[model samples]
Target: MTVALPSILLVLLFALNLPVAFAIAISALSFFFLADGLPLDIFFQKMVAATESYPLLAVPFFVLAGSLMNAAGITRRLLHLADALVGHLTGALAQACTVLATLLGGLTASSSADAAMLSKLFGPEMLRRGYSAAFAAAITSSAAIITALIPPGIGLIIYGYLADVSVGRLFLAGVVPGLLLAGSLFLTTWWIARRRGYRPTRPHFAGWGEVGRAAKEAVWALLIPVFIILGLRYGIFTTTEAGAITVLITLLIGALVYRELSWAKLPGVLRETVLDTSSVMLLICAASAFGFYLAWERLPPAMASWMVGLTRDPQMLLLLINVLLIVLGTAVEGTAALIILTPIFVPVILQFGIDPVQFGIVLVTNLTIAGITPPVGQMMFISCAVLRVPMEVYTVEILPFLAAMTAVLLLITFLPGLSLWLPDLVMGP
Candidate 1:
């Protein structure tokens, strides 16, 4: 009754369109008042404690760095580079959109932001080139899922933080899977473009000179991910320190190298960062209180035990988890789901001898896929709105891309080495 009441209230609040943070906070607070001997002060303490962690500082720093990079015109250079590299292919604009999203994934780490940017930048261009608005909106929104699987992904950071796993390893582990996703989306777009006889954006392949110039222009932005990985690997900085360092590097590049970010624009970028950070951190705070309630009731271990009883095999257990996460991802906000569910699932997976790092990648990837799904998909709505496409059209066009994403999810789920190889090679298991 105690658990059911809060769970039901959460669903009701979500249906009522309440903010996820308040829904969680309100539902969680109900537990203290309803349950005997539970003190209200503990709930307040839990929310405060959640934001007090040194590692949690990475959230705001990375969010600010991403905003600064975009405001400084890094995204334009990246788009140009993506076009130079892939703009001659069949469905050239679509291909470039995928590639650009992959690159921006390393920079922005927000799938919705990537989707919104691509929709505005390439959406109309694709339409002008005879591509359907649905196709453009679908690819733009779906490909942004790549951002959540790449290094410095916000989802990866939050999952790592909640699961008590190594954030560095999580970042290292995401590289191959992220690329695989990009490639899958690229191939899917190519197949569709070829079948439909869609014209290429460029009349000819980019010359070496053009490629070199594009690369040179985007080199500073390209180095951000490499710098972060190297910094983490060589003990130059902790994960939190890396976020701070990234902000410093981005500010320098924006002000001096690119010379695009002006003093007047700085305030706007900071405001965007604060807004993004506040939404995310507030969810974290609420989830912390809710998690405390769940812990008090011993729900995590109980759920783990129930799940373990269903299957002893690690593979089967993971498959079940994938199913659950996919459903939850479609319905719940990914960050809230990550914070609330990680506690319950971590113990279950550990008992099956699954690596937390590998599981973290899989978890983040699955939830990110949901960001483009229907009904409540934030990215879906963003793309549809920016492209002025109907939801039904966008949903239909997204089917194949969704299939591709699902395939990648299954591949990562079953192949531990795919997620673990780079991390193990670099960090040593």
Candidate 2:
């Protein structure tokens, strides 16, 4: 009952509406206190140790980079590029929002940040142009999940750190799956646009010349991902170094190249990054203590053994785990779910000889989707509040996009090649 009691209490704390970091911290303390011989001091040690990680440094810097990039007008350039590529299609604005989300995958590496930005940027415009609030919110929020699947995804970095897997491999592995998600959404948007009689923004496609010009203007924005992947693969920088370097580059671009991010804005950006980084670091510290508890109890190995006993079939086991992740993700925030569960699941999957890189894609994708699930999905709340769409209405509207995303998720699940191919090619497996 020692371990089980704390696990139960953690759920109860969550149900009581406590903050996630507090919930995890309280539960770990309870375990340490009630255990027969475990000292309370080690809990504090684990908490501090989690923060000492070099890789964890990537979190704060990436948050700062994303915020400054947005302020620098990088997002605006990419949005224009998104428009050039798809603005002539049926449901043109909706299609462009999905495309922008893909581009944002590199820039923000954050689903919540992307969701909030997309909602504020496109929510009003889509509504003003005759799109239903439900449709606007659904499309924008669903597309935001794609951002977390792409390279430089903050979630992937966290997963890689927690699981002891290579972050660079995870980053490269995400490219194909992220694009596949965009393609699925594009098809879904086309069907919805045609059915609703939503018209295009432009009468005809932007010619190659227009697309070329848009790409030219957005070239600086586009190079960020290429730089990150190449730097990591080539051993030019560690993940932490890559994040710091990117932040410096983005600040210079914002201040000098675009001249959009003014000197007066530096303090505000730092303040925002501190707030974002604090929440993430706090969660990491708390979750790490609880993680120590799991290790002490040997829970992950026991769980892995139990599953392996149930079905030696790797495919069946993965399907079951994905369902659990979806259900768990609906309650916990994506990063929290990832931090708490990665230690448990990674060991389980590795038993089947599964590549952690492929599973990382599936795991992060499921959790991001949960970020959009009702009735308390973080992204869903961000989008609905901004667009003024009710949860019940959004629950209905997001169904089709959710299905499309699930299809893409399953493809990544069953076809390991989809996730592994790029990483193996680029990084030599």
- Candidate number of the best lDDT: 2
Model 2 Cα displacement at 95 (Å)? Answer: 0.7
Question: lDDT for model 2, on a 0 to 1 scale?
Answer: 0.91
Please identify model 2 stretches exceeding 4 Å from their true place: none
Clashes of 1: 0
C-alpha lDDT of all candidate models, in order: 0.89, 0.91
For candidate 1, the TM-score is 0.98
What is the Cα-based TM-score of model 2? 0.98
**Candidate 2, 1-429: lDDT as tens digits:** 666999999989888878889999999999998988888899999999998999989999899999998889899999999999999999999999999999889878778889999999998989888999999999889999988878789999999998899999999889999999999999999999899998999999999999999999889989999999999989999999999999999988898898999988888888988988898899999999999889989999999999999998889988999999888877777777888899999989999988898999999999989889986588999999999999999999999999999999999999999999998998896
User: Where's the lowest-lDDT run of ten residues in candidate 2?
Assistant: 327-336
Q: What range of 10 consecutive residues in model 1 has the weakest lDDT sum?
A: 328-337
CA RMSD of all predictions: 1.1, 1.1
- The TM-scores, one per candidate, come to 0.98, 0.98
